[model samples]
Target: MNILLSGWQALVDYLTIARVISLIIAFFLSGAISTFMSKGAVMKYFGPNAKKYISYAIASVSGAILAVCSCSVLPMFASIRKKGAGIGPAVTFLFAGPAINVLAIIFTFKLIGTEIGFARVTSAIVLSIIIGLVMSILYQKGEEIDPNENMFNIQEENERTWWQNLIFFIILLAILISGVKHPILTIVFFVTLVVVLFLYFKKQELLNWCSETWILAKKIVPLFIVGVFIAGVLTAIIPETFMVKFVGNNTIGSNLIAGVFGAFMYFATLTEVPIVNSFMELGMNKGPVLALLLAGPSLSLPNMIVISKVMGIKKTLTYICLVVLLSGVVGLIMGNLVFY
Candidate 1:
């Protein structure tokens, strides 16, 4: 009964107003990308034929604009992948989206040491790109080309102009960033969104957007809830003392354990900063702390389940291994060389 109550409490804690709003905005924006953004546009930057320099650079650093958690970014990742993005850029965006978001980085700098904060940002971007390039090289030939590639070679006449779409996305992102924290800004953005929809978009187009959003929500939300509940149960079962004991030294084994634990555990948005700081206070090594920082935000049990459904078991497992390996190795380096 106590364990059950803990799990229930965790679920309640996870469903804060700000988090709900963020998820809603993420859902809508993902739907908008799928419904409104043209295949040609997605392909131009994220497709297989797209320039590696441009696609990897954009995907690697794109998280600066988004402040979502690992789970919140899944729908958008799926939307782009289905819309004709190649595996490499899609993977890059998936890892970078949550790992190096502006809020997370800033919070790390403020709560954690500036050294770890800078290291997290630099390592996340670099590791994401390396993982993306590796995945691209491994799977490029095996990637199934979209059958409609020829049709999307040119932008459809019905698609909104690029600048118009950009403005619309900016407004949506504003709502996401402000959320409930800035109620006034949220209201203003909402009103502007309505105005833009009425003036610039047709009723049918709006309906289609909502429909796509609903579809993504249906596919991801149920699994997300389950994953969250399970994660909560794990948190209740795994004592913090046990984790702290093993990770108190800056060794390869400790770093690997931290990386693996972080990969499977869920950390909501900037929550990892405080959690990691608390661990450091408990005598956790700087190396394992860095490992957790790298892996915690980018991958989670719920995140893994959802992405597996989107990308399949093989690709999902491979992504997980790369993230865990790289995070551990980097954390080890940071602990031994940079800090020590």
Candidate 2:
């Protein structure tokens, strides 16, 4: 009874107005990102034949814009890979797209701590690019360019113009900001969001954005709730001494375990933030937290299965090794820098 009550109390405390608003922001922005970034654009710069520097740079940061989860990123990864994108850039985009999105980064900075949030974004982008480059090198053969392909291929007839997409992103971002800021600023941004919505997005686009947001919410929200409940139960069941014993050390094995655990366990987008935050609150080492943040959003069991089909077993293994190794190394560095 005591354990059950503790869990219930934890859940109630977790569901603050601010967090609810943040979740809404994450869901809607994720949808907006999906709607705006068409397959053609992703294919153009990230295609196999694109320049290493330009393509990898774009790939590294693209996830910040896309706002997908591990599974959601798989389809995009498959699309780019199928379109003959270089193994490196596609893989970079694959890792980056879901792991380091703007909304999640902001939420992490706000909910977790400023330092870890910054570390999460920096390590995610840097590791993604490094993994891509390493994979390309190990493979030794860049993909062949298809010169006959049209550069301006449009995947959808109903896709909005680039400016329209920009306005939509800004308006939605303002809504997110409104949720976190002072009441006066919140009111101002809300008014701006309404005006922008009325002035810019057509009726159909508005509906499409809403529908996309709903789809993401439906798929992710229930799982998020369960995760929070489980986290609460964990708080009651797992003693702080035990967590500090295993995860508090900044040793290589500790970081490796964190990376591996993150890879195998499924974290539904921003849920990783709170999950990690909860663990951190319980005295989990900062280094392992960094390791988990680096690996969790980009790799999962389902994510791995689909990746094997998309890129084959050997390549998939290479990618996984790179992610885990890089995450561990970075964790060591971060542990020394931040907490040591």
Candidate 3:
């Protein structure tokens, strides 16, 4: 009874923290993205006939800046695809956008260590590019969509100046940095963001934007809470020995298995950090940790379900399998040569 009660308490705490933080970050980042990054620019440059490798490289860097989760990238993926991006390049952007981002890398470094942090970034970039190349070759003659005709443009009429956008970006960075240690600071940051938006834009426009952001939050925050609660329960119920037995040696096989499991498991945005921390306490090896880092953010059960609805089960499965295999292979090599 005591154990169950404690688990329940932990679940509530985790859910509260994760949901609040996720919502705040999501709203702020999404607003900033919609405001600053121009769709015209993206289409003109990364649109069709763009060099496959070059597109991959650009996508990797741009993705790092967005700081979104796997599911969050879906709309952006569809947008770019409609804007004339090839299937392979668009898919690379889809994967890289969430997989290898500055936020995830920084979080890993702060929670884990410098080595794992570097490895995670390296693997995300390399795999994104490689996967993009292979997918391009395989689907070179696949269905091509015209960007101008089909892309969704959710842009609002009001636009901010370049300087204002830059300022907003800087504020977001500051908020994220401060939120790492102090959760309350996030609230302050958000309030300040709202105030800034109100001052800069028309009242009606700001209200509409806030309403949309709230709608998105309502949809995602509840799921995030549930996920965190489940993670907490798993932490309390699962034995440490189980984790140690599989991922303790940083061995090639162990890392591969870990990668496969991570690919299939659902990790809500930023939830993997605490989960990985729990596993580390159980003596999970660095190799497996690397594998998990590579696979977790890019692939998830809920994400797969949603993707399958749009891309069909076959393509979704292929994507998931490829992520697992590639992450496992890279993690194995890095674990032995660099981390060992």
In TM-score terms, which candidate is top? 2
Give me the runs in candidate 2 sitting further than 4 Å from their true place.
37-39, 142-148, 155-168, 178-181
Kindly indicate the candidate among 2 and 3 with the higher TM-score.
Answer: 2
Clashing residue pairs in candidate 1, if any? none
- Per-candidate TM equals 0.63, 0.89, 0.74
* Clash totals, every prediction: 0, 3, 2
For residues 67-158, could you state the per-residue lDDT of candidate 1 as single tens digits? 44576679878976886777898999999988986556755775577899888999899998999988888877777767444432556566
Residue 108 accuracy (lDDT) in model 1: 75
lDDT of 2 by residue, 1-340 (tens): 8877766776798889887887787677878776656755655786545677988888888876555666668888887677677788888899898888765687788778888888898888899989988988987474565543454254665445778667767766777766765677767877777787787667887788889889877887777777677677777888899888878889888899899989899888667877887788788899999999998888888889999998889999999988888898899899998866
Cα error, residue 82 of model 2, in Å, equals: 2.2
Instruction: Supply the TM-score for candidate 2.
Output: 0.89
lDDT of 2: 0.79
Kindly provide the TM-score of model 3 when superposed on the true structure, using C-alpha atoms: 0.74
Give one digit per residue, the lDDT tens place, for model 3 in 180-261.
4676886788688767766776777656656756765665556645655555667677788887888888777888888988
Candidate that scores best on lDDT: 2
RMSD per model, one decimal: 6.7, 2.6, 4.7
Alpha-carbon shift of residue 41 in model 3 (angstroms)? 3.5
